[model samples]
Target: MTELSRRELVTFLASLGIALPLGRAAFAQGTGGGGDPAPGAVAADAAAGTLIRFKEPVPYSFERLVEETREAAAKPYDPVDVRFADTLERIDFDQHNRIKYRADETLDLNDGKAPIRFFYLGRYFKLPVGINVVDGDTSRQLIFDPKLFQIPADSPATELPDDIGFAGFRILEPNSERDWIAFLGAAYFRTSGELDQFGLSARALAIDVAMPTPEEFPRFTDFYVGPSAVGGRVKIACRMDSPRIAGVLEMDVKKDGPIVMEIRSRYFAREAIGRVGIAPLTSMFWYSETDRGRRVDWRPEVHDSDGLAVVTETGERLWRPLNNPANVMTSTFGTGSPRGFGLLQRDRNFSNYEDDGVFYEKRASVWIEPKGGWPKGSVQLVEIPTDDEIHDNIVCYFLSEKPVAKGDAIAYDYRLTWAKDQPDRGRVGEVVATRIGRGGIPGQPRPPGVVKFAVDFDGGMVASLPRDAEGVEAVASASRGELGKVDAYSVKVDTAWRVTFDLKATGPEPVELRLYLKRGDETLTETWSYQFLPLAQTG
Candidate 1:
């Protein structure tokens, strides 16, 4: 992750997390994986030929196709090729996510609406996903048909090949008129953000990620998309392989309010991997809850997620507030086949953010549910302290045995729940606000202290007590400082309580602190954890 625009950063400095523009490789590849729309064959798939016509039963079977491709890719990267029909040849991005396959043209005509639309190929996306519609053995496969799409007469759109196949497809609501999910870009795909507008993305597999060395990103080379009539769901099965890994994917995308995708993937490592990330979510967490008065803009926060929540395999729920560090920060929590983890937006107040456009507070919280029992590993959260929001800053995933190794078979399945509220297992004492300033008391002589902290926590049993309640105690500790007087009492507004404390930072290194309210024998709320960066250099 790199730096972001000063404008976006100033507003989102509290929850800072970032990633650079999808380098060309992160976008897609031409081989067997689901990558961007293959660009070179832009103008034409062939010099000239009869438009591919579907007669009756298409001969292709997605299941058999995947089994064969996986076996072939198991050897080495010889570059699996697709002999595409002319109609499925050259399309662009605008044309990709927008080209709606008409109701009459719906391939699987079993039920309601088969959400079918294609992704066009272009600069950020180049690898073409081999798409073929099946009707038993008589598969009326696809060809890049420019007529199916009506592009706004623009610069990039006008320059594309007339017969380019669609880059990928987004599934529309089977009953409603809107879209529910999409499989586009690189091995990248997503449902809409908090407001039903698409932002940020999730990758099927990540290799050598966040390393100083150049990373390897595998693309989804082909797709076996179908309709699941048995369970009232849409099924999308993907065949994935790269220079480093190979696998299969079966995703059942369903919709309630926010669409949910239950994904199961089988991964095979072709070589030793330094970092293997499972259910990796790439997002921007600029600022939220912590850094406020120092903002460079009017908005209080700008971020896609505000915290990291992990449900260990034993069901112990832990919430770590997201941070915007001055440098790249990576923490690997050593654990077993973790139950689940994800980037989340816990606060859902509009006034807390005060921004009308790009609702930072309303952003969705994505929860990754493990497919099965995973082996011992770590749930890694990489936070790159940055100044802007354009660059993605938050990456949460599972780092497996040595990242990767030759002849390693890694399989995982998880449910992705996209919603506005976080998935907190208990009455966790959630962290509300964290304010930092000079340590001196108001109107008193300023001391030698450089920094002070005021952390506010609400929710749980902490609010039901009286102003003089003594049964509840505030347990506070710091890694490198003398902790000061800690006090707790019920707040006047909303049945919430306020816990205030001060810390005298004693060293140059950051101070790690954890605090929670407990009434003697019982815990009142979820523990609030924080990592405070040391103050700036003074004269």
Candidate 2:
């Protein structure tokens, strides 16, 4: 998709109250089986192989898909056209929810080890993706069948043609109604995380996100789903294409408390990508305890994630608390072969949120770990302002230091872990919470041109330290500010150490603050980094 068209498409989807921005397509004419075939009957002509039919399964492999993507990228881009007739056009949220896929019609793989279901085409998701079932070295494309869905006879979706095709697909838990993994719009896919609730989404490829120009969204045109080499995991090969880029992604996904995806991807740039993001993650962060004054919600907190956690190449763990800034903010942490990074929902106390409907505490943290020789880059974070929780206002990804030129062959290997907490590689204390307020001593007028931060650190060695532990000290610094009243004290409530400090800003420019707890020069916690935008400047 071209940059302008992609922006328009995503804007349209957001108008309909979707979670993440994804491209959509206009209706186009296509041909498929006219009627619903028998349960195991072929639905396409055997002579034509652009699309597959049950008549015969053809040979397929990930390498073939990679070659196909490479060749496609070498040529000009072609966008798909999609259309939905009468009832389907009126498939609003309620009506769409009513049109459910039949469990019996699910595509089974490895003798029912994996059961896949299709999502019906709707107003928000108009593009159709090819879905194929792979077995051994061969694969068969599943034809669209109205009978696959159980739609209300009175629903407008019934007016759609027999070959309306599928919007996306999802993988269901064995013997359960809940789905653990799903691939929806564009190149977006997500799992139900460690807590069994959907939160953030991971994209196959990201081009020029948070740049001056509009972001390019690569769409997955086709997906080959089959059993994995290992038991209990499903393998999906995706063909991604866009105006600026084309790529192939092979993902082996499995759910065992924490949902894990072993992703192998290769891309060919049709044009020089200004800024490409690897293992890009999209999420929402409206407001939390750190900026409670800015929040106008009844709930105590509202967000899918609260901070961006990173383990740098030098073994330094940094936790940068996320913010819904007044304007777009992009922070880059340079590293070489970084260990991992993620958008984390660290505060898991239900009492802190009191959101029973959309259990924010149950949302999962998504961490990206590079598997092979990762190129040098910076873990970049983009925080966009949002008034409500529906919009995904936060994005994090690894950006290579060098730009991707046209015809460049790009490859990356990474594993995504969607869990409740990131692995404690440092085994040191970590930031549990961050709160900000006006700076001043109690019972006195709040000081001007200053901000107070109360950061709580818990877990690992810090939590084990006694209340009267000696040698423990708070270390704080700022890029462009004067630090004042910095001290670490034990809190009674959560067995965590609270570091209270005040920052006297030198100017209206944003201040980069860093702090941590230590005992006689021995580091005791992960570094806490934050960008403090002066109130006067933010307004």
Candidate 3:
């Protein structure tokens, strides 16, 4: 993605932060996404959250069973045979999100910390993650209760056969009455970004995210949920399966303090897996401060993640601003035993988003701080070109030194911070804003052959320097376009310094853009790398 599209992607993805909480009774009454289950399937006499009696209940040891997942990966991947399409395929968005398990009928065994609320089947979400509860040595099925939910008068959901199950389930607040996390939609899940607002999604694993072949979305085939040790975090074990790989995951989740999840996975590759992305975060970058100039709309910015922040093993911090180009783009920051990397929504100002419906400022900037050292690797970011804002185009993940193939096992441990700002790792200047227009001096006809750009740098070294500080200069280069006179000047009104330059494009093609601030060659600010969009528009 280029600078122009980055601005637009920022504007679009930021708007998707509207996935708010479903109220108590409000959820049960919701008929959105998908409708209710067939009434006939839900026996007329059955009440909500009832004990589901069916196949002989088989009890299993939680710890021993989790380890079994590791053992299961050693064998040839056996495809899961459960199918539930008739009840899922016909459903749409509203019906899918509407499949709210009744709040009153929440599964409460006094075993798991909280009862589970199941999401209904619908269009976007059809396959449900199997839900189960466990105690010291016993496991039980969480019965599906229809009376637990309130249905709309015209709702088309009919309670179906008792044997029918759910897609996946969401874990509500552990200590508080709030809903902090959820396990829904694919092998995807996420906590509210730094601001407690759910935005980007973290998948258990990505088979081939940016590949041409249809991206195969694996499901958490089953969940072994159990109670936490007295006053401790809950332990939910997961078993994942796809045509390509199979593995297990143990999520040790806490509530108020920093929410950290430890993930250990192995791939029993059906064949050579294409691209494996660990701790992959999925988000959208439509347009923002730097790329807004290319937009023809009313909004100022849109995006869930503005840039990709990577910390190398040597402790070097690098920032790569996101983009939405006319074509797919892939960039990698070389590093070793990466300390951390993630898609961040660093810009936190309401003015950035004029749309009152979706508050972008409150969106969380998730920082993936690895708990243990990840072997030599690079933080790879893939940006896919997108015209509209609905599709997520930004993907960030760490590639380990180990090449991915069949029978390969990978264990990754990372701490997911749900706070607002990045941790106090180091001091560095931040890219405040980026803008573009006709390249030339004021009062002069716009330079015929050049595209002008203005980049703002604030905070860190730049903000502390004396007003008349010398040595500070702008370091910039173009991947293809020719660069002209470049100069740096303070904005006067703010602590920001604006770097202006003209790029002479050879033709209609887009160009890769890069810029940064330095003092006597000592780098003081983040290197601002961007993609300059070249769209023909009437002035």
Candidate 4:
């Protein structure tokens, strides 16, 4: 089998309505070109078999699943064998859409709070997953039934057998008109966020992503859904396997205002996996205001997430503005059991995006909160280049300090909140905006290769301070460049403070810049860090 790059996997998943999380540059090697199989007409298989049945109410528990997955990981990986995969692989987007799950067949789980609908096997989603329902202490596997799908007569999906199973499934809203959460395409899953628009995605695991070695994509082969003992909560269990690791995941999901999920993951490595990423988030940042000249898109801004926010263990908050760099870039922040981190869509106004169709402004911001004392690790942010919004170019996750050897076991407990904003500790001010332009005097022959940046900070104690407050200073530094013409002042509009500066390039490499507002001995805002790619975007 030819190893697939992360971009190729994303391209295939995006075709199936599951946008791949993360981005890649325009000039960089991409897998989004043509040659995907076209949609074909219905070709029913005469030898279709009946749906397979497992004993109902079989004894089951979260612990049992973890144990079983551990034993499975000790053995060699076994890839799925899809029957009539060639025909299924031809189910294009339109054809896949036509093969919808009938409303009458929606599973009535959890006292009918949300109906469960199965996704059909298609070209991009060829792996069939086993699904089950749990009641009390027992669980029963759900059999695949072609009759559950209303396939168009012209679609080739009818050719698949009744026992071919499902690609993944979704949880329909109370009205049954739309789905709020979906798990499809490998280990990828996402919620509609607090705004009910699906933009980015969160994965179960990430292995060696953007590394020299080809990335490993683990898949959830089975799912068990049940009513949680906790009030108004649902329990979901997953059995995931891959060439590198086998694991079990359990989530106590609640459709609160923020769609909170308490996730517990157990992993047993099948091999000596390097660089395991936990609680991975994937998003897209095409051309925002900071790099307006990068793309010719009509929108003023285009991005699902604009920055990666982190709260260190010592109560210090840091904000790193995301970018669509010319080349792939990875930033790691070493921390000892950090409070939390997330990729956030802080700009909430529709005017910022001017995209009414997709409503990018309403995209949700996801945050991860560790349940206990997390081991020493680093919050890693990987930014890839992309010319279009269709490609997800930003990925943020936690990398463990310790390496995992073959047969080693790892466990994590965390909470995922899909909210409009991250939890505000109200410790200091926040960066509201970041803008860049040609660095030079207004009309004095725009200097070559100089970039100007303006960062806006608002809220917290600084906004409440009098405009004439003295001793307010902008402390800034660059890792590999010369900082010039630095100025900081309080802007009357919105009672925000703005810092303007010019960066004189010292080399061709990208520069890491950090700045924070302070008044005498007291810091007034969280550190604002940005990656300045001199050669990537220019006025």
Candidate 5:
């Protein structure tokens, strides 16, 4: 797909009206205590009209849902029957935003403590999904009615049928006006995170991303929402379906200080799959401090995440700074039952971003911790080139060692934490900044093919070292280049240690570089692994 089309698809899927800055009072009504009503009951607001209507209750459980999904996989994939494609398309962005969910119509869960709101199907979101409210062992599907929304008189949505299903839903924080988590378009979902600003997103699964063939986007066809066993948390169970796969996913989401979600997914493949990405994360990485030459906007930096941090099964820490390469790039790190991994926006300085509108500094970093023993696999990182921050060009996920075949049943369980920083903070120094420039002495002529790299390290042991500390050395290596002028020393301005090196590429191929710091026999910093594109030498 073209870059613009890809950006549109991902951007719209990640967020629509869910992240808009609407007033809290608009969604703060109907907060009184009330239990879930019986089947066929109508949640109505006398002044605002009917809010929600439910169909007959159905027997529901996680196990039964899994069995149902497996049976669906055995049959041919069934596509969603969009009710009014033409009319819905007329409800463009402006018109769609004008149609709002009335505040009094909010669906109350957990004894009216948790408020839920629904999104109306519009131009981009035509394929609708079933939404159900679960109470104890039974679930009642919400019947779609036009009365739930306040549609503009000129909007084309009024022409659509009343049975046109919902586009997605969002969960509002109790006693607050803000929404913490939202699921919309495809199987994509995201939370406001610890910063209360939506940034990166997580998907149910990713199939053959960055492969030669077109990527398959398995969408959530149904969502069952209920109260979690853990008080003050919400449990969401989703049924996902695609041409080649069908799966069931359950997430117990808690929004306290940070958003924590325990996710369990089970998949039954209908066809042989080349690549299956479990716990896939999607974020935008257009440009950062490492490659400032690619900046197109006035902002100092524009990206949701700046690097990929991995904790290998062997307890080694690796940090790979993100890049916006000239071409699509895939980097694979062999991780056998990894301890943890995440895409981090480590830079918290507001001055670094300068843009107060989006507050890039406040974007939350998501960390994934595997629950059970995951099979031997590799954490694959795919970086797609983009000129703007609209596209979500960075995707990373865990790829299984064993290929998936038809009728293969696979399962994965993990915990997702949307926090201010990564959860696993080791005693080793962490990479703080990465910069590249000309490779010669300041007063000397710059080399044509050589590039200079300056990486700063701080935290852990590096922060404790004295300025006059001795015996600390920089360890550097390249896969296909000559490394020289290596130097590591403490900077007078900050507690961080600075490491600089010159790398001369011997060929046109990209070079993989590894660097770290050590004192005597002790390793002092996490390994900084980088992929240097030959074209980036100009920067």
Candidate 6:
């Protein structure tokens, strides 16, 4: 997605009722009072402390949270009250940006090793969510106080009441000005990753995304945060509620090189859902090298991720390049308890992007590694039409084979890795780049209704093959077109191999194309799967 304007961002946040607070301040020397005070200590400070306040202690645990969620699903959905809606509406983008969370009031965790801060409610984020600090078996709800934020004198936020709730919270990089992980707006949360650049975002669950009906965004109404049992990790238990579903998510988040999150979620459906997307990843894909014809910027390429990479349960690897379709398109790949899948930014060269301001090349590639045994499902990819990068038009998620029904209780466990690369790509030739153009040989009259595809593969056994490798061939197939002029050879400068083929479309419908390099009967590279839009292909 391209960079969103402040106004556009506000609108987007307003639609999702989620907003990522802006601004960062230098880390203060002292703790946000004191590190995780003993059980009732924080509650005791409710009457004494002015900067931070907490409600009476309450017994809490992940299991209790799940049970509470199940109970919530059995009842009618209750929406969070928007306190001082008029005042919040007055706090526009400019005024909201001026309102900053007080760094001195940060809640210290792990002896101040990880500083936690709360987000202020604004125009886009009028609804408040419960923020609690967990201490052992007890938790205290953080009381909202106007003093927690440094608001401009002229800001409408000044009109908000002292009991007004928070929009979200973020975990700062220990003693650093920047934050590593942030949870805001619905069930959306993301990390800066190892490169310190935030790109794609992952949602706890997605209902009816890209479906005929409007999508349902489950909001994390409350969060219980504390130190994790695992060393150097923070545990966050969230209570998510929606009109159709109620759920609990327990995340063990740790930042070791690549930010890793062990996520366990349980959902109770209040009503039947047309589609349920688990561990859904949302990103932007406007234009890339392969689809340069749709470029609207001066940069060579613009996208958060380049392709959707999936490893099937049977060990088949597939790479599908992202697209900016003319219309909303959904692709489904039957992946029965797939090993892993993710939207990756494989092209890390800065030269390819030429975008220093946002550093598109440094965007993190988020991967979902399923834990335990997932039921038979398909990895669904939804590509919506987007002219600019500001819009996140790409969504990838796991869709269970069975349809979700009312009273259906489901659970999913997965590990999320936000890093520069996927966790396990396996020992195989991977697709480095995919380019398309007019079909046929250079300097010759190109065939009508035909498109040329050039796929480059690097590493794996393909790298070791000779330039004139005997028996090496490009295996190609198309769903609704004829494939010809297939060729495969090693590049002169490097061990990278290149596969070229031409596809003649017989109809206007999109064609599913697949290609891979093979030496005799042995597969030499990961399968390159693509949706060839005949009508959208530019000559």
The segments of candidate 4 whose C-alpha lies over 4 angstroms from its true place after superposition are: 1-55, 443-447
Query: lDDT per residue, candidate 3, 378-488, as tens digits?
Result: 878888876655567778887765678876666777776656766644666777677777778889777686778888888888787666778888889888978887998
Q: How does each model score on lDDT?
A: 0.62, 0.78, 0.64, 0.80, 0.83, 0.81
* Candidate 2 ranges with C-alpha deviation above 4 Å: 1-55, 84-88, 536-539
Backbone clashes counted, model 2: 5
User: Which residue pairs show backbone clashes in model 4?
Assistant: 22-392, 22-393, 23-392, 23-393, 24-385, 25-385, 42-154, 42-155
* Model 6, runs deviating above 4 Å: 1-50
Report how far off residue 403 is in candidate 2 (Å): 0.3
Predict model 6's lDDT versus the native: 0.81
- Model 5 local distance difference test score: 0.83
User: Residue 169 CA error for candidate 6 (Å)?
Assistant: 0.8
lDDT value, candidate 4, whole model: 0.80
The residue-by-residue lDDT of candidate 1 on 1-539, one tens digit each, is 11112333222212222222322212111111222233332222333543344434445654565567567656887664543322223433223323333333334333655646565664334557767554444344566665444343433445556655566776555554455456655576766643564444677876666699866667787776665544666667777778877877777766567657878787777777788888888777767657664466677777778778777766555667787877777877665778778887777788877866555665678888776677788888888766666666777788775546687777777888787655445565666666666665789876676456666666655555665677877777777877765777676676667667767776667677777778877877666667777642221
TM-score between model 2 and native: 0.89
Rank ordering of all candidates by lDDT, starting from the highest: 5, 6, 4, 2, 3, 1
**Over the stretch 503-527, how does candidate 5's per-residue lDDT look in tens digits?**
9986667899999999999999999
Report the Cα lDDT for residue 500, model 1: 72
Residue 510, model 6: Cα distance from true site in angstroms: 0.2
Q: Mind giving the per-residue lDDT tens digits that candidate 2 earns over 1-63? A: 001123223332452345433324321011111123324332333354333234357889999
Residue 278, candidate 3: alpha-carbon lDDT: 78
Candidate 4 clash total?
Answer: 8
lDDT of 4 by residue, 1-539 (tens): 11223443454365334654453322101111112223442333435543234556788999999999988988998887777878986786545645656554567778888677777887777888989999888999887777656566677876777677788888877654567788877788888878887778898998898899977888899999988999768899999999989999899999978899999999999889888999999898887778877768878898889899998878788999898888899999876787899999999989888976667898889999988778988899998878776677788999888998998999999999999989664668899999999897896998777889999999897788788888899999999768889999989787899999998885668888999999988999999988888777652
Candidate 3: what lDDT? 0.64
Instruction: Choose 1 or 2, whichever is better by lDDT.
Output: 2
Badly placed stretches (over 4 Å) of model 3 are 1-66, 74-76, 80-84, 96-99, 108-115, 134-140, 145-148, 151-159, 174-178, 227-232, 508-510, 535-539
